[model samples]
Target: MRFLCILVVLFVGLKAFSQDSVSVPSIDTTQHTKDTLTIIGVGDIMMGTNFPEDKLPPNDGDFLLKDVESVLKSADVTFGNLEGTLLDSGGIPKKCNDPKVCYAFRTPARYVKNLINAGFDMMSLANNHAGDMGDEGRKSSMATLESAGIVHAGQMSQKTAIFEKEGIRYGLAAFAPNSNCVPLNDLQGAVQIVKELADTCDIVIVSFHGGAEGAQYQNVPRTNEIFHGENRGDVYKFSHTLIDAGADIIFGHGPHVTRAVEVYNNRFIAYSLGNFCTYRGISVNGVNGLAPIIKVFTDKQGNFFKAEITPTYQTYATGVRIDMQKQVIKKIQELTKKDFPESKTQIDDNGLITYLAQ
Candidate 1:
């Protein structure tokens, strides 16, 4: 009887092992169609009245961005901060700190071709510089952006823009911390609007101009900034909250320097991209241009699976030429390495930081 019981137990054990050894079929995740969406974003583009001589020919005032045409065209979508109005009228009222060098920018309506030629699909008009020319200037900016077929968001109409590509829908929203610019008080409403768009679209990208200026590098979260004695923005908590409400990518500016990069819930957030093509006389503020061209891949269901980053630099002077820089790649990696821990990035010959998602 004992021999019979032992035989039965051994037989059951063998059956269990056999069942465990049987292989289960793996799901073909790669079978679904995949597409790579490359998004190139830049910092402040102060292409205004700094040049007294280049008052733009009547038909082509937007010619300032002619030099970087090839570079801009390489990307699928290009975005930047339109620092001034593009209208032909509206004279300057309040003078800048320097009179001989006081800055007020306006361009002919036709120069938008330069931006289109530079591969710009969209821009953010919610900046301090946008209203520099007053209500008329701001109105002119809106009209110019529309005329150029370039989509913009900020203190303008339709806070959220719905853009479709490759059969995928994307929502873009721009915000700031003040009414004069992108008032911080409007954040809750903006979040709600963006969240609604996220629900209906595959991805949502939010751009903001905030944080203090100068050589300061540390992220002073929760603290609001008062630029020129006027409230500018509240970046820290506002950004994280936006992520919670459903923002896939968040690009920040106004710091005039690269702040930091973090991955939250598989989404990418760049605290500050620094100066892109700000030809303002300030040298230090325009040094290492760290605008990143981010490429993202999402499933049909809008689930972001991977991304890459490319870094570029701009020389701030008469010739606002942008050059690809290698150190910028190392800087971003080193900055994000501690937070991501497994963050890995490589710089290509063209000075693009290709970050591998962990």
Candidate 2:
């Protein structure tokens, strides 16, 4: 009897211990990982003077984007479309004022530091202004951006950049798809490169300077927005291709106007960020001037978590200060609502983007 009682007590104690062990939580640390990546992107950052009167030192142009410096730097990464070349050695292009010829953008080398100060993590030099002063100017822009430690993409050889943050590797590529923008012949090559990068990196971000200029019917959908036999780009199709090839985010610009944002294949594509900050451009400032900004959040594995757009309006003609007028904010809200009905654009009393959704 004594032996049987002792055996029962031991069995009971063992069972209780087993139950307690099972109740303990799993020790996996993935849930506690503090690695959340954020990328903030803006639109055409024109850094050139239209003429002698419109000319400002490269440093002067830097002030144009200074207003959003804090907001940009707050993100893990920030990027924009560098609208012009950064070479001061070249003369203006002869094609200026050809009706088809638009503007010449050549920033002085001295102002390169301002680009860094403005919180630009990356800049795309694949726009029309890239070769404004010709290939020499393009070369100079490349060297200048590199000297400032700014990652640049959209060139023939260095078409993509790889960045490692936390434990995640990010690959960024930019293309134009026609003319100086991307050269349609290189479309397949661009896609191949992005795919390869996607295989190695945790996330892939693609940028393109495409889409038709002005508010036209064709601009609503996707069309080959070529001008004077030159191919600028087709924003809609360009984005779709990149995403299909494993891109996590697609940033589009060069239309000088904000287009629609669509979620395709579980990815977010900003068709056109419009004009983020440009001084010397009047045609771009119609309606509510230019309001554009996109925010993205991702996890350690580079999976997108959430996104939102902060609409901003630059005052027309004045060229300084964001238009904080209530009517202007409401107008952007109405425009964005056309595509993202869940999106709401609200401005605070001081004229800042207080809240945004969808």
Residue 151 C-alpha lDDT in model 2: 69
- lDDT per residue (tens digit) for residues 265-287 in model 1: 56667777777655444333333
Model 1, residue 1: distance off in Å is: 70
Give lDDT per model, in order: 0.59, 0.62
Write candidate 2's Cα lDDT for 1-358 as tens digits: 2233235335554222131111101111122245667888888876555343456634456566566666677777788888777776655452654744476777777677666876777888777777777677777887787677676777664566654444455567788753344453366776787787687666788888876666552133556666656666556667778788888888888667776665666676777777776656435546425665667877755565666455566643343344445433454345545755543433343323322324
C-alpha TM-scores of all predictions:
0.73, 0.76
Q: Residue 12's C-alpha lDDT in candidate 2? A: 53
Clashing pairs in 1: 62-111, 176-182, 177-182, 177-183, 177-184, 178-182, 178-183, 178-184, 309-353, 310-353
Please report, as a residue range, the 10-residue window in candidate 1 with the lowest summed lDDT. 20-29
Question: Where does the lowest 10-residue lDDT sum fall in candidate 2?
Answer: 20-29
User: Model 1, 11: alpha-carbon shift in Å?
Assistant: 72
- How many angstroms is residue 51 displaced in model 2 relative to the true structure, after the best TM-score fit? 5.7
